[model samples]
Target: MMHEILRQSLRWAILVTLITALLSILLHAASATLLRGLPLWGGMVVVLIIILVGVVFDMMGIAAAAARECPFHSMASRKIPGARHSIVIIRKADQFSSFCNDVVGDISGIVSGAAGFAVVVALVVSLDFHEGRWLLETLTIGLISALTVGSKALGKTFSIRFANEIIFRLGKLLFILENRFHIRVFNVKNKKKRKRKRGVLRAPRTD
Candidate 1:
């Protein structure tokens, strides 16, 4: 289990780094060109907009993660009959939570790293350049940061949605199995009825 966890962590780290790097490069290029034609104040406004977008995306990612980890669905399955089916449903739900935690942790880490890089870039640009150039640099950094956060948010949302769907399907399957198989593994009514019949049969030849 520890080995599996470590492997998953490594994979997530690498994926997040690659995604963040690619997005940063693309955003840096695009923002650099776009901000070139804008006035200093206009560039600052654009940069702030980008930062706001990043923050929104980050919040969305967190929300989706929270939804994925929620135990409501699992709890609902407890009302289902049949111990075997309930166990399967609960296991699937637990797996969903585990996946959510890993993916969300990686995304959160990426967002933090990207935000730090943006801040550093902003500070450096402010010190190294003046007026329009500094504003343009800040805008570029902000755009890159926004892109990184947005991409992670989108990816996480997709993952969470997919996981939820799987859990739903699993729950449905469990219901079907319970109805069709009538496993009676934990059917209290069936067990009690069988016991009563047995008792009647064994009640001696009182006839």
Candidate 2:
């Protein structure tokens, strides 16, 4: 078990690092070119949008972790695809939380910071805020940080309150994609599943 845990952890570290690097580069490029062209308010709007995405996913991660197993079983018994996906999320809540909240959320925060800097640069160039340019940049960065943290703090309450419903809805979406488009974002294999497969392989052939 310890060896397996270590192996999984190592894999997660590599995957998350790669994903973070790719996303950071894309976001930084976007900030440099796309956000730089926007007006101060427009850039702030972009920052807010990124913050919203981070907060929403953070809430989703918490909700998935908090959801009970019985509902997933009931939904699965009904042959629901979303419930099936939700079952996997619930089974590996820690990993889900790390992916959604830690990896994605942290990336969003970093990108938003870059966007905020772009906003400041835009303001400094377009507006006559040359007197306290440094101060303006500092305030912009501070405001973005405050909003991001505040939104996540508020989102946590909602996540905890409506965890089951949120997870169920998310499951439905996953179900649709998996059934209709055959797209699978996550297909984690549990130890029990591996054991069952092994048992079948080891059993004497009836035929």
Candidate 3:
């Protein structure tokens, strides 16, 4: 059992590493292309938007980890669209939280930093202010860092207090994505009995 767990952990680590690298490359390239011709203000706006994405994803990660699965079961009995999805999130909270907090959150942070750099460089070049370039870049990076840290700190507290509600709303969005757009985000299975189920996801564990 220990061996299996070790193997699974290693496997997941490798997979996540590859996924993160590829995603970062794609996102960085896209952001660079988008910022190429945009003005300093426009690039700064894009950077702010990316920071917002990181904050939101961090909130979802913490919320899923803190949410309870029982309440969602009750909602599911009422034929609520998002209730089932919420259960899935709570069941796989560990993985979901890691994905949101580490993968998406980290990617967004990297992209935002690159975007901030672009914005600062554009400002310096546009104003022909070479003398203050270093100082301006330092301030821009500091502001971005402050914003990301401050917002994420606040988000953590808010998400914990309203974990279930946050997960439910996110579940509703996932439900729409799956049903309307035909995306299969989760698989239904019985985590306890190792049996096939329908319309839900199960947490993996050792019995």
Which candidate achieves the best lDDT against the true structure? 3
lDDT of 2 by residue, 1-207 (tens): 999999999998899889889877886787667675766677778888888989998999989788888877887788765777888878888888888898889989998988888778778877877898999988988998899999999999999998988988887888788779988877833456433344445567797
Per-residue CA lDDT of candidate 3, range 42-126, in tens?
7888898899999999999999999989998889989798898899999888888988899989999989988998898899988
**154, model 3: CA deviation in Å?**
1.4
| Positional deviation of residue 22's Cα in model 1 after best superposition, in angstroms | 0.9
- TM-score, cand. 3 vs. native: 0.89
Top-down lDDT ranking:
3, 2, 1
- Residue 7 CA error for candidate 3 (Å)? 1.9
Query: Which residue pairs overlap in candidate 1's backbone?
Result: none
Best by TM-score: 3
Give every collision pair in model 2: 82-171
Span of 10 residues, lowest total lDDT, candidate 3: 187-196
Whole-model Cα lDDT of every candidate shown, in order: 0.50, 0.83, 0.91
**What stretches of model 2 exceed 4 Å from their correct place?**
188-207
> In candidate 3, which residue ranges exceed 4 Å CA deviation?
189-207
Distance from true location, Cα of 108 in model 1, Å: 13
